[model samples]
Target: MATGWLCHELYMWHNTGNWAQVFPPGLTVQPGTHAENPETKRRFRNLVEVSGLLNHLVQISPRPATPDEIARVHTREHIAHIKALSDAGGGDASWLTPLGAGSYEIALLAAGGAIAAGEGVVSGEVTNAYALIRPPGHHAQPNLAMGFCLFSNAAVAIRHLQARLGVGRVATVDWDVHHGNGTQAIFYEDPTVLTISLHQENLYPPNSGSISENGTGRGLGFNLNIPLPPGSGAAAYRAAFERVVIPALHRFKPELIVVPSGFDASGVDPLGRMMLSSGAYRELTHLLLSAARELCGGRILMTHEGGYSEMYVPYCGVAVLEELSGVKTHVDDPWQPLMMAWGGQDLQPHQSLVIDKVAALVARIS
Candidate 1:
């Protein structure tokens, strides 16, 4: 039950300059902390230490991904653009995605962290691992950086596993509240990788993650998007997994399972409109672990993604780590009781309809 953990002090140093959450401060807008700041990730690491869970986990050191490694998933121009911006002392990577000096190097480190975690699981160095790296990468694309992401960390890691480690049939289950557009696009036409994203419908990136946006060419039906309605909760998510996610994984039978884990789907996150609690995340982790055990030799690698609630992200992270490591701490999520009791925590008929549609797509995965 060895769970590999990766974090670097420099991860917190990737500066996203002072801007109101996702916007540059102006006369009309007040300057405040950016939504993707370091506090959430730093606090998550700290809580792991405070909860004594860090002691039970194996630490994995991360190296900066080589330009060639990043090129596996990103274009040379896009890579050069980020480096130039960082060299010029920081600028926006794309719409609303900003970075500061040395951010290019930090982004490389984040991608490397993801690769390290995947290597740990694939090499049997750890049963499963979680890389709590910063500057979330799910929203990044091959040529453009969007949301708060620079490099598509999960995509880079998956490419590394396939091209370098001789692994095949990798599946990514992204429950990040926002569409994993980048990861989806990277493997959209490739049948070897199954990309499943359970996100809020049309929340970010505008008009993306529709049920019809499955996959194209040979990859059709291999990509699944369960766009749960806003305010979806534990019941909706559980239904999606049992009816869509787990079934797809079983059909695909991936050699490794990658999770773009994000806590923004939690009840307290400012960016998302969902109502999931820490308990819900624990349940989801349990389900994924069971599926991995049966389908992928129990190899699961989770790379950190969008989660803005500094206060609550730590609890949600700990819950997942506890399940991953089979170690429980005395710390309890004080927000669970309230979040679980909130309205719309049960599965609505509308949510069921969405899940049913996505469930049908699972049959297409050969």
Candidate 2:
């Protein structure tokens, strides 16, 4: 089995219009650009192609998810609202989340790419797959679209797997710097899916992703949140995965594993303050791959979530694809050394304290 890479150029065309543009034209913000531009994702694809890894993977076509498939995770009102906005020439659907004309169709394709990738993995068509979709989905809620996300791509894909393929007990691990509020909300009361998010504390959507916000009702012991303090580096993240994520996955023993992979946690991301490096992403992917192999026969699907550093995101993505495909390239990340040399690259005592605190939450829920 080979890894599958899913992408389409239309995803890049789903424009976010323009942001505030630096508050006052050409002053404070220095002419603001769209936070959710296509360069980061497009560059990631280019890097994959340039590295030759794209040739080694299965290329999956991007399809539009059926309305029924999407409705399983999103409200009809929300879907209709998005479509109407697109028909009316586009506008902001929620806070900071913009939509362009025909964005509705592009969003469908993004979610569909995730579904296709998930299906490919669970059906033994691929050992693992990575869907490089756009309009990151972890921030999208059942009725609301925020944080540059439209529909809950990961949630929709997981629901599709359960309904269409009869897969059970999915584990979604989100390492997206920001809390996966939408995902956490969707499965907050459903015990079949275990939602785990590792993000920066008190960041994005402020006050979300708290450790105490574990699942409720039947899902009480199924949800877990690991909010690392800002400035956390490679060591801090590794510790969180080893202590919290790995242990939880082992205990859950999910039939399939899904990751909302995000690159914004890297040191250079403008929207994030963490200190992850490209190699750090590679190591995280390695850990997840190992866990998937052990607990689920290597049935894993990763959907792209967030990453804003246009220059660095490509390298980070390349590192992840390399691990997923078990391939190496002559092109190396020249910025890795500099990023790793930053102050927070090594784990600090305080960072460990935070991880320990979050890791301890698992026991209560377990």
Candidate 3:
């Protein structure tokens, strides 16, 4: 099992400036490191190397996605807007989303990294791959950038696969603790791609990711949203996969599986209220791998998304990578025991109700 890793140093250079968490500095908000800073991604990369896992994977290089490539999913005006702002030494892309000089170029590279990872998996260059690119992109819309995202990386890559790579059906499994509004909207009217998001209810981007927000037109019933309650943990997530996600995949029968992977659902993450350990993420990956092997010849590609915990994100990332590559390293997550023992780790009746409701939607996929 050759798992490919795609990353570029410049990915860490796409600066979001000094803002307190998600806010710009003001009289009330003091200047501090942004929650979307590079440390979380950098630490994930560092652990892969320090734990000897890096040496076991295939390394794929990223190239800048051309304007034509980006045009597949973004509007011309929106593309030019980001470039203009980036050229003028940086400015806000949207509410709570800031960028520094040269960020536009880096955003292009981030989208390109997604393309590279997808290509690696589709072309059989690697059995599976993970692109650790930055400037998280799932929150970006066709003409607006928000939620710390500048481009819809996963959406752009899925478009490229359909238009240029001759691939037909693709499915996205987004577990970001926030709604994947951008990806959902981009493919909302098309049935070729199935977008399933498991997120905290009403967490980010207000009034989004509702269970009733299924697909539209020809895409009706193709999109599924599992808005788990705020305190959902390992058992809830596992039950979601077993009951809803995996069955939807079996019904859709996609040729490739793309994950907008995010670790923000970690118990200690300041941005979310879910209680999940690295072990839970490992199990999720295991389930996905089994489904991919059975349905898609083991073709899976993942691109990084929102994960704000600088200390714990690396452990979750390493666990997923370890599962993908089938290699074990000496590194063990110190926080796992405590996270697994959290009060809500067991599946509660309330969580089961939500899962049961979403599971009924699976029969509508075909």
**After best superposition, candidate 3 residue 279: deviation in angstroms?**
0.5
The parts of candidate 3 lying over 4 Å away from their true place are: none
Q: Please, what is the TM-score per model?
A: 0.99, 0.96, 0.99
Q: Which is the better candidate, 1 or 2, if ranked by TM-score? A: 1
- Candidate 2 — worst ten consecutive residues by lDDT sum? 21-30
lDDT of all predictions, in order shown? Answer: 0.94, 0.89, 0.95
Estimate candidate 1's alpha-carbon lDDT, on a 0 to 1 scale: 0.94
Write one digit per residue (lDDT tens) for candidate 3, span 61-170: 99999989998999999999999999999978889899999999999999999999999999999999999998999999999999999999999999999898899999
Candidate 1, residue 258: Cα displacement in angstroms equals 0.2
Off by over 4 Å in 1: none
Query: Against the true structure, candidate 2 has what lDDT?
Result: 0.89
Q: Rank the candidates by lDDT, best first.
A: 3, 1, 2
Of 2 and 3, the candidate ahead on TM-score is 3
Candidate 1 per-residue lDDT over residues 55-82, each given as its tens digit: 9999999989999999998999999999
Q: In every candidate, how many clashes are there?
A: 0, 0, 0
Predicted structure with the largest lDDT when compared to the true one: 3
lDDT of candidate 3 at residue 63, scale 0 to 100: 93
lDDT of 3: 0.95
